[model samples]
Target chain A: MRAEHIKIGTSPPISFEVGSGECLAIDGPSGSGKTRLLRALADLDPFSGRVFFDGAEQSEMPGPAWRGAVRFVAAEPVWWTDTAREALPPDEACRSRAVRVAAAIGLPAAALDQPLQQLSTGERHRLSLARALADNPKVLLLDEPTSGLDPAAVALVEELIRYRLLSGNTVVLASHDAAFSKRLANARIALGKKPLTAHAP
Target chain B: MSYVALTYWDLVLASLLLLINGAISFGFRLNLERSLAISAVRMVLQLALIAVLLKFIFASDAFWPTLLFAMLMLAATGYEVASHQSRRISGWRGYALAGGPPFAAGLVTALFAVTAIIGAEPWYAPRFFLPILGMIVGNALAGAGLVLDTIADGANRERQVIETRLALGQSRFVAMSDIMRRSVRAGMLPIMSMMATAGIVAIPGMMTGQILAGAEPGDAAKYQIMILFLIAGATGLAVLSAACGSVLLMTDERHRLRLERLQSNGSP
Candidate 1:
């Protein structure tokens, strides 16, 4: 599956591709359309382009099925629910997995019952990650997933990403953090620079 | 209206509350003077006009004019809600789509609860019709208005989040269900607050009006309870209808929020 043309706002346009099961990390300066690319691919942005997933038409498939595979988690997630328990799926298996994910990410077990307003920024971000991971998507996209986290939290998120990648998920993480990107990315895609750098070969 | 019952101290307290309101605006250095004055002027002028219109309109036995007036009021209420939420809601049709379901549902609820339940005279008498319709329209306005603002802002701000869910195989309505519930809950706060107050905060306008018009306080209080229940019912229906209608209206086959139409302030 890939995106073509991909214009957003009045900014210069960019396009790219994602082969099956290959984890790609979008690395560039802030406001470099990394999130935009993900949004466009997710069919969330208003763009003039073609996007396809696994030879099936993105526009042709039911939105639910298309979205079921393609998921994007924003840097600053807006939660619809106030409680952590309400945020995750009600299914026992998914709920227990979310609890495990939250604990691995350094969130307290009590966070599940606490109101969202009570959680710190890092905890909230972890909750967002846990929610996305619960959906168990084929395409797990993250926008600066560890940008605001402390060093320990960042390492934990990296561990989670690595775990997902090991599970054969197609992971695309967008970040400007070089050291973090190098550690987890199988291929790096950069944006918003004068000359293109293709080093994945 | 006994001066003995309403003492000079009661007058003093009401004035003191108004004075405190004015003082807080000044004390906090909040610059609300221009809008405050304008709002006060508009309130006075509008109420004076309504008083004059109601004097003659209430006395008339003819139902056609009253019905026309009620319909126009409902349309106005709906228009206010739409215009307040988005400038892109171009014309009557755009407003109608946003406004129609809530108004119809609210009116039906109000009619059933009032005539069937309260047993008002002449069935559609203007006295009952105007006040009952006014209450319905007023609450419906608040509920519809809340839905409009929330949905418009929600569709834009949470567009990506919503789209993410849809891409992940969540149906459009399923994606919005949580957000819709939250928005409607926020909308119903005012109604809930009013219900909490009732007689203790001074009788509501409907009951107060009936009392002044020579009805016994006990009789008016029963009617007030009925009106409150109907108004609450109408608001619930209006809010739910608006939320569901707006979501359906704004979604296409791809399940994307129709931003083009709203951004242009026109229907997609």
Candidate 2:
């Protein structure tokens, strides 16, 4: 996946590329357009630039198709449905994969059947990540994936993401966790500074 | 029994009942006296003007005049629908979006009823065509307005929920399915309740009017049933179309939520 001269909300034009099995970390302060950049990459926001996935342009494919391949997981995700299981994709394969991801993320399989209102904030956040991972997209745009997790759960999430990377998926994440970013990202970019810089870790 | 004419003195006597409301407003210091008086006067004038206009249309009984009047009524309905929106689409497009579906649905349904069902001598006969169009348009105006309001407000309130679905690769229609369903239900609620309680809870206005005009009770009831069915059909179509139209306006071809298209009416 690659973006060329992408501009979001008065931020400097951002350009970056990540290959298969690679992770790119976007580190910035609060209100620094990290989430906005991810949204643009997911094609969920209107941004000026060209994004290419596997040699096809973002605009070339339909929005849903592109987003399905390159999914965006918000820091605080939203669930429209009532139960945790209902929030995952309704297909059989996705549901099974979601169960596995849930278990791996330290969420019990029974938690999937519980109503969303009963779940804690951290539980909901983990469930949201599990839901995105179940889709197994080519690229994952994760915004602050480890913000609400305890050290144990955060380690588990790191392991899950590493497994995803081993299986040849690319990831671009924005986070304030310096240790997490250093461990995961091969290349990094910092926003909010003039003339943004991208460099290898 | 023949239809009894209402004299001006009878209207004066009946209007005296409004004083009860005025007295209540006064006693409570509700500050509603001015609005109540203006509303009462406005109602009287509007109804009186409509009666005179209907008399003129009935005397002429021509197709063009009837069509012209129907179009005018539809335009007014469109304005009313647009005005009901708390988060209105900015420009003339707002009016078009609010009014277009109901106008098409109401006009088509009324014309079908007049030409095919009633089989009036001249299909566009002002008396039959105008009344049928008025009822359908009136009901459709309410329905379409409700639908627009619900959809616009829901879109604003559920921005995160909807955008999350979009981010999950759901199509715009799929992302909007819940709100669309709710809006359509809201639009149809009034008509549904009216249908449920039509004969037992209260005699419907059309039936009552027909009975007072010396028609047989059975015939009046039959006509009422037909009108009710027409209203249900028209309102359903209007609401469904309004939902679809609103969804189109709220999103783009890229399936991004374009909430910026909606301008807030500045109310909390």
Candidate 3:
């Protein structure tokens, strides 16, 4: 995934490219367009720059198709339906995979059958990531993936990100955890910092 | 059987009913007497003017006047639909989105009724075309208004939820498909309720009017059935058109939900 000269709201022009199997951490202060940037890259937010996946412009492709390949898991995850399963994809295979992913994310498989209102905030957050991964996206846009998780759960989420990277999927993670970014990301870009530079590739 | 027409004296007697209601309202201090008087005045004046206009229209053999009148009614209805929305789509976009559906549906259904059903000598005959078109346009206009209002409000309220679906690689159509169904269903509810309750709880106005105008009970029933069918058809078409239009207006070619495009003028 490559985003070039992307400007959203009051943020400065930002650009970066992470190759297949790579993880790029977007670090920023609060209100520094971290969420907005990820959304722009995913084509979920309006922005003024170009985004490309494997040399193909995001705008040139159908939005849904582009979005399918570049999945975005929002920080405050939204569930429109009652059941957790309904919030995921409708296919049976995806449902089973979601159950597996939910378990892997430290959520019980029974979580999928539970009503949305019954799920904890941590569960909702993890479930959103699980739902995004169910599609096997080429590029995953995660906003604050482990914000509300316990230390153990955060470690598990980081492990999952590493696992995703090992399997040749690209990830753009927006996080305030600089230590975690350094531990996992191949490169890091900080918004609201003067002379923003892409770290060692 | 011949029907008796109400005379000026009968109208005077009808005024007594309103006076009685006003007296009761005033005695009870219900604060409704002023509104009741105003409503009565408007209804009498508007109906009187419409009757005069209809007389002129019915006497005319030209089709242009009839078409113009239909357009006028459609425009008024479009304004009503747009005005009723909580998040208004301003300017011509609002007018087009609100008015276009009901007009097209009403006109098409009216045409179908005149040509296929009624088989009038001249398809645009004032007597046949005016009343049938009025009924169709009126009902379709109300349905379209409800549909537009429901959809606009729904889209605004469900912004995050829809964007989440859109980000999940669901097409705008697929992402908001459920809401669209819900909005259209809500829009059609009144018509559905009226249809369900027709003849059991209420005799529809058109049927009652037909029966009072010396038409046979069976003939009135038949006409009512046809009108009901036309109304249902028109409402469906209008709701479908408005739903599509509202969805299109709410999104861009890139299939993003542009909620910013939905501006408000402080009127819901």
Cα lDDT of model 3 by residue, B1-268, tens digit: 7999899899988799888888889899999988998999999999999899889988885799888888788788778777777776777899888888988898899899999999997999878988988888788878888887778788888888899999989988888897899889987987888788989998999899989999998999999999999999999999998998888888888889987877775743
* Per-residue lDDT over A7-70 for candidate 3, one digit per residue giving the tens place of the 0 to 100 score: 8656678888899999998887887778888889889867799999987999899899899899
Candidate 3, lDDT over the whole model: 0.86
Steric clash pairs (candidate 1)? A64-B169, A67-B167, A67-B168, A67-B169, A68-B167, A68-B168, A68-B169, B88-B265
lDDT tens readout by residue for model 1, B1-268: 4223446687666655655656778889787756676776687589778767777787885678677777777678767667666533445656885668567866797678658876767777776777777877787778777776777677777776676566445777987776787778877887889899998987798888778777889988998897788878888888888777767766767776666566444442
Identify the runs in model 3 with alpha carbons over 4 angstroms from their true place: A91-93, A193-201, B20-38, B265-268
Ranking by lDDT: 2, 3, 1
For every prediction, compared with the true complex, DockQ reads 0.34, 0.76, 0.73
Determine the TM-score of chain B of model 3: 0.93
lDDT of 2 by residue, B135-239 (tens): 988998799899999999999999999999999889999999999999999999999998999999999999999999999999999999999999999999999
Model 2 per-residue lDDT tens digits across residues A1-201:
999999865578889999999999998778778999999999987889999999999998999999999999999988898887887888989999999999998999998889988998889999998888777789999999998889999999999999999999999989889999899999998787434448744
lDDT of 2 at B118: 98
Instruction: Pick the TM-score winner.
Output: 2
Give the winner by lDDT: 2 or 3: 2
Stretches of candidate 2 off by over 4 Å are A193-201
TM-score of chain B of each: 0.77, 0.95, 0.93
Best by DockQ: 2
CAPRI-wise, candidate 2 is medium
